[model samples]
Target: MSDVTIQGNILTPAGWLSGAISFGERIAGIQGAAADPQLNGDDYIIPGFIDLHVHGGAGKDVMEGGDAVHAIARIHARHGTTSMLATTMTAPPEDIDLALTAIGKAVRQRGKNEARVLGAHLEGPYINSGKLGAQPNFARAATLAEVQRLETMAPLRVITVAPEIAGHLGLVRELADEGMRVQIGHTLGSYEDGVAALEHGAAGFTHLFNAMSGLHHREPGMVGAALAHAEYAELIPDLLHVHPGAIKTALRAIPRLYCVTDSTAATGMPDGEYMLGRHTVHKCMGGVRLPDGTLAGSTLTLDQALRNLVGLGLDLADASARVSTHAADYLGLQERGRLVAGAYADLVVLDRDLKLKAVYIEGERCDLNDA
Candidate 1:
């Protein structure tokens, strides 16, 4: 027997259906009729978001280690993220080890009210020092032994590296061979370098146009390479990172472009200084930044990211895919990012204005009031 049922304009892989879904920890069945041809509706039951890159939330930084990842997961769960990667920053070896140890524990002890901690996205240490963006100054070339050691701390699902760094191109191929989703980022590499990384097994670009080299008509930088060659890439749709026009351009060029929060410790908290790895960042004017005004990360949650995509003239279904489906597919998660029988019962309910009404992770309803 099903443990719960919900009625709404449901988003299914086949399309929208006006129906009631029955479920336990996994969906049992759906029974209902078709919705408007346009798929318009005030009430929506869509697959919960899967964020590939998340730093921290609820006033806790992932670098703090310990039970901090649990707190971060709870905050993102309130914002409709059913699953996420506990992204770590460019930091010392000991700090990274400490953070990943905690992330591994969180993955094993996921709370009923928190989002599933899929694994870690190490966005540090193996990057270009010349183009650190908001990352700390600890960038260095990668070694397979070091990466394998870190993976022992937790499943390193994704690792961001700069192709131009000595030996990293080969490392990208090696990591990809070992089943890690390698990405090119924090790079000053040229267009040729980006393409070489892809040829060598890097699967995507990290945060697309930020921190990496920009496109130029004559030069055709890393962004140009991603636009021309990548099948999947992540972009921050917070409107503060990449301009809407630039986002639209990417949409036309890349087939499986997805969105990520790249959120910081200030997420879900008031304007103030917070730690993003080793640096102190300020959250003000709806964005997080360093004191000198370099865009640090963001305070954006996935639910808000969905709204932002829809506002950019995309239909609700397409917007939903960018925030949920694409990310799930990118990570090879089969039972997530879709609403259907046999999939996990992870979903979000939204009212007319796209405000989050409720969220469920693995069929357990989250207490939004406590967030």
Candidate 2:
């Protein structure tokens, strides 16, 4: 394939560049590009944001068919996310299959809109029922055969399960060996049990401190263990999923701190009713929830998450690391999530005010303001 270069003020691993980069059609290196298109940078040029967890946006849910999925992807891409893992909340196994298979196809088809689909993050249907929060309790804990069937569905990247479930640890290791990230979340497990799963290769925590137990001096729950274990913790920084103070606290507690946006289908839309999995959540003021008003998912976009970080007194470099650099490291996507030479030309440009200016996904200008 021929190269389509993007020459602009660049941001490399070393730092911002005074010149630009030669982006190729499936970028290999500078020589990879057939032609170099210069994009003069009056804006901030950084690697495109990668969202590891998100449901939907732009008044559409990923669970809806093609149009909705593609539309949601476009909406996020315009806002600076070049790629994302389409996350599925707890739902029936049949629905899970449909969503997973559809997402796999979307990734392969390269979404009618430009945001690349990394894979799918099946956040439930494998979690504990007793501890279930926003997720429908009826959609909890599938049999082993049910969970195993997912290996054939999509590139299952991350699965959130409660380790305390019987036969869960075995399943955890099973998923870990299959190259899927096993994250302990939406559970009520003791510190020892949580640590044991981590020792057995459970590598992440989902939306820390929300929909889970709180830390205690005597009973140190999952939150306590996650805080104690510095190397792992992917907290959602939407401020609603967690309070601002708690967001600061978790960052200080964890050594390898990172941010994730558990954005629901209602993100970037007017507040109202929306469906997530088997339950319908009421949306208002950027928060999604169930009928009884229990907080479900969030209405946070990657842009808003970054803006929140800035508002919380974090500098662009530090905030960018948590949102972009650190998250890529956690997912072990060796080549993505950074602005470096030879890396994929997945980039986003923003104004000094931090508003999204444009985006390039794998060298294609998802937005063409500069053109």
Candidate 3:
């Protein structure tokens, strides 16, 4: 790879300062910014965003498999995400297997300008049907045999399950033992049930406050457990799926509350019909919703997510951590989600207005115009 140098006010481990980053593939060096009398400090550089939960973008869903992975990666790259987990919705066993197989293939053969496919986040057939928010018809208790089979098929990084389901606590323990992140979501689990899942090794909550129990002053359901106990939780900050006040509450209560797009095929496209697994969804009025008006997913991109956090009165550094650092730590990826020497050359450049100006993935610049 050829050497590439970027000059601007860069956000590094030491904090935001005038600097230049020079790299080939991995980051080679970060230095004081080049002397330019015309420098306005309007241009800024930050580590590329990493999303833990995303289904699709650019009119393709993960359930479509194969090239759909690349399409999603390329589209999100245009929006400054350098890495993400291909989140799968609840579906038939064979459909799930196919999606996993396709994701595994994409992981092994990622392109230069595409975001890295870290692994798969199985959002489950092993959840409560009562809370099946936009998920297709299949919902069942996870079996040991099925879990074992899934482990062998692909790189499974996260699994969202309902601990209240019969025989799910043991399943959580087994998945956690295998180094997979077990999360609580799509369930009717009470506060005690959520606590028990955590006791058995569940790491966090999926899209907190959505498809899960709410915070009752007396009952303290899933939302309460997440805020009161869990180390990490994913929040959709689109202002549609969750209210801003609730976001503030979670931010104050949880130690590490990161953002996830939970974006669907309708993202980055004109308002129209799109696919969310076997279900058809409509994208209109800047949101994706089911025929019956239930929010199917979001049309949010991480760049906009960062902007949203900043708009919420957070400083740039803190906002950056929510979109990148927190999610990276949750996934156990130490080298990603930060701008530093020896890390992968993944970064985003924004203008004074904070609009995306450029994106670099592993030292290669992605063409935003492609999508």
Candidate 4:
């Protein structure tokens, strides 16, 4: 017998269809609409969100250690993220090492109350200081020895780099060769530099249009290259990071653009002080910002990101892909991000209005109503 079964208007790879998914650890079977007579017919069953870029939430910063990993994962899990990369910020070498060590431990010890930690997304040290955004004061050039050591420290699935940094284009090629998903971000690289990184094997863009070079009509910088080249870009659809008009523009230009929560420790918490790397961030006015008023990550979760896209008039399937499938595909995670017989039994159930009601990872439902 299956451990659990849920019936709803499910989104499948073929398209949205009415069905019931029965499962153990992975999906054991799929049943047609008629099979579940008890189904309410108003709930939505879509693949659990997989966030490739997320820093922390619930007053927990990833740099705080492995326990912070569980804290952050549990917070996002309550809102429909079943899997994610535990992201790190630009800090001193010793601090980054500590975060990576903690992330590696969390991957092995994850439980039902938390989202599965796929790996780490190191978002700093190798990035440019010109467009540091919320990152701290310790940026540096990419070094092969440091990256190679970090590679052994944890399962690094992605790294954000500036192609214009001295000797970084070659490092991008090397990391891509090793199957790491290299993304161009936090930089002042021009359009030509972005094209060069893509040519050297970079596969994605991180939190597009934030901290990166803008799309000037004449210069056509990194933003223009990302849009024009159709690179797999992760965007924060929190409605504050990029305006609705710019989001619509990105949607039209990039075919594989997806959503990520570059959330800070203030996310899911009351307005107060919280940490983003080494800096203290203020959370208020429905957003997070630094002392200088720079956008310091966001207070967004993936569930609301889905609602924002649909609110912008995107069809359900397309919005679903942005939060789940596109990021999974970019990381080459074949077994997750789909609600099929062979995929992991990870998903979220939403009410008719698209509000999250429940979340499940590996067939076990998380405590969404916890307060």
TM-scores, all candidates, are: 0.98, 0.90, 0.96, 0.97
Judge candidate 2 at residue 262 and give its lDDT: 78
lDDT of 4: 0.89
lDDT per residue as tens, model 1, 254-361: 999999999999999999999999999999989999889999999999999999999999988999999999999998998999999999999999998889999999
lDDT assessment of candidate 3? 0.90
Residue 299 alpha-carbon offset, candidate 2, angstroms? 1.4
Q: How are the candidates ranked when ordered by lDDT, highest leading?
A: 1, 3, 4, 2
Question: Clash pairs of candidate 2?
Answer: 48-347
Each candidate: how many clashes? 0, 1, 0, 0
Can you write out model 3's per-residue Cα lDDT over 20-80, one digit (the tens) per residue? 8898878998888544323565588888999889999999999988789899998999999
Candidate 1 segments whose C-alpha is farther than 4 A from its true place: 37-42
TM-score of 2: 0.90
Q: For each candidate, what is the lDDT?
A: 0.94, 0.75, 0.90, 0.89
- Candidate 3 regions exceeding 4 Å error are 33-40
Model 3, residue 80: C-alpha shift (Å)? 0.4
Off by over 4 Å in 4: 33-41
